[model samples]
Target chain A: MPKVEFNVDRCKGCELCAVFCPQKIIKLSEGINKLGYHPATVKEMEKCTGCAICARVCPDCVIKVYK
Target chain B: MKVVFERPRALSDVTTHYCPGCTHGIIHRLVAEVIDELGILERTIGVAPVGCAVLAYNYLECDWQQAAHGRAPAVATGIKRALPDRVVFTYQGDGDLASIGTAEIVHAANRGERITVIYVNNAIYGMTGGQMAPTTLEGQVTATSPRGRDIKQAGHPMRMAEMLATLPGVSYLARVAVNKPANIMKAKKAIKQAFMVQIDDLGFGMVEILSTCPTNWGLQPAKAMEWVDEKMIPYYPLGEFKVPGEVK
Candidate 1:
C-alpha cells in the first residue's frame, strides 16, 4: 500500500497538504500536537497514490510519501 | 518500497519559525532539495538577510552568514570572492532585496558577481507586520498602505526580474511561483539553474520566487495560494526574463 508519514511535531495545522492532496486523504487530527496545533494525517492509507503532492505543497515540509 | 518524497538531506531536522501557511518553508525546502541533487551541499554557502527569513541558517543546514537588512548580495559577493570554489548564494525577501538592499543587488549583478540570488518576493513586508514593500502591488492593502497602494503616491510596483534582466552582468534571471505543485516543480528547476550559474563561474543569477504571506494577507492558507494565481501571477507573469547565452 502507498503510504504517507507526518512528522506530527513539525506540523502547524496549515491543512495545505490536505488541500493539495488529489485523493483528499489528508486531514487534521483533533488532538493537539507538541506545539498545540492539529497535525495533518492520512485519512485513508489505501487511497494514497504516492503522488507526493501533499509533500510538495506542505509549507512546513511535514509529509513524506512512499510507494 | 520506493520513496517518492522525503526530507532533503541539505535541510536541518528542525521546526521552522514560519507561520501556519507561510510559503517560505516551501522555498527553503526547494533550495535544499536542489543543493542535495546537485551534490553541492558540502560547498554551498548561504547569506541570509535581515527579514522573515533572517534565521534561514536554522533551516538550511550549511555554512551561512547573516547579512544586515538588504546586504545579502554584498555579503554573498565577498564570500564568493574569498572562496571562489564554494557555491555562494543569498536568500532574501522583497523587503530586504527590493526595498532596503536594492543598491547591493544592483551593483552585485551589474558587476557580474559569481553568486546566486534566491529572491523571495511576497510583495509585503511579512516580518514587519505586513508593511508596504517596494514590490507590493499597486492598490494592495497593507499595514502601511491601509487604503491600498496608490500608484500616484508610491509609483508602480517594481518588476525586479525584468528590471535586473537588463543588467549586463546578469547571467540568468527568472520569475516563478510556488502556489501549486506544477509551479513548484518549475521553481525547483529555476533554483537549480540559478545555483548552476554560480557553480559555472557565470555572472550574477537570480530566481525571483513569488511566495505567499498568508498571515499578513489575512487569508486561509489555501486561499493564499489561490490569490497568488488569481492576482500576483497576472501582474508578475512567470517566465525566464534572461538567459546567459541568449543575451541577444
Candidate 2:
C-alpha cells in the first residue's frame, strides 16, 4: 500500500497529474480550493500504486507520494 | 517509513505565480531536487531573469539575485567569478535568454564561465503577453504575430542549445522537456548533470527546456504539451547537443 498527499491550496488545477496517473485514481475535487481551482484528489486510494507519476507530472509540486 | 516523493528542501513553501499548467513549476522543482541531492543548497546562488520567472527567487530557497531582462547570464558570470567556490546558476526564459540576452549568453558560453543556466524556451513570450520570441516557430500565431510568425520578417527561430554546443567553452549542453513522465525524468537527470559540470569546474553548461504556454498558446494544458511534441520537438529536437569529454 502507498500513501499520497495533496497540498490542495498549492494546486493550480492543471490536472497533469490526474492525466498521468497510471492507476487512474486521481481526479479533480468537486469543490474549489482557495485558489478557485479544483485541486486533484485520489479517487480510490487503494488503487494508487505509489508510482509517483502524479508527482512527476504536477507543475505545482502539490502531490507527495509515499511508498 | 520513507518519503518517496516530496517537496525538495531547496524549494520554498510559498506558492508560485505561474499560471495553471505552466511547466516553470516542474522545472523549478527539478532544479531544487538537483540542488538538494548535490548538497549545494547553501552554497548555490541563483540569478533570476526578468521574464515570467523573474520572481524565481520567491520559489527557490537559496541566495538569489534579480537580473535585468535578458541579463541573467551576465549577472551569473559576475557571481561565479566573485565566488568561485559557490555554485552559480541562472533561471531564464526564451525572451530573457534567447532574445534580449542572446549576446550575454553567447559570450558567457564562449568564455566558458563555470555556471549553470536553465533556459526555458516556450516559443512565445509569456510575461509580455504572448509575443513572438526568438524561439517562436514559423507560422505560429502569438499576440504580436496574430497572423502567425512571418519567417521572412522575424527570421528563423534560434537553436540556442545547438548554437552554444559549437563553442569550446561549453562542457555540457542538452535540450529536454517536461511534457511527460519519461521526459521529465530525463530532464531532471540533465539538470543534475549541468549542475555537476559547474561543481566540477568544467565550464559553461545549459539545459534548454521546451516548455508550453497554455494561456498564451490558446490551447488546453494537455494540448499545449502535445503541441510541444508535434511541433516544437520537430524543429528543436531533444537530445544532448554537447557534453564534456565527448568527441566532436
Each predicted complex: what DockQ?
Answer: 0.87, 0.83
Query: Which number leads on DockQ?
Result: 1
lDDT of 1 at B210: 96
Off by over 4 Å in 2: none
lDDT of the candidates, in the order given: 0.92, 0.92
lDDT per residue as tens, model 2, B65-134 = 9999889999999999899999999999999999989999999999999999999999989998999998
lDDT of 1 by residue, B20-61 (tens): 989999999999999999998889999999989999999998
In angstroms, the error of model 1 at B129 is 0.6
Interface RMSD for each predicted structure: 0.7, 0.9
Off by over 4 Å in 1: none
- Chain A of candidate 1: what's the TM-score? 0.94
Clashing pairs in 1: none
User: For residue A49, what is the lDDT in candidate 1?
Assistant: 93
Weakest ten-residue segment in model 1 chain B by summed lDDT = B239-248
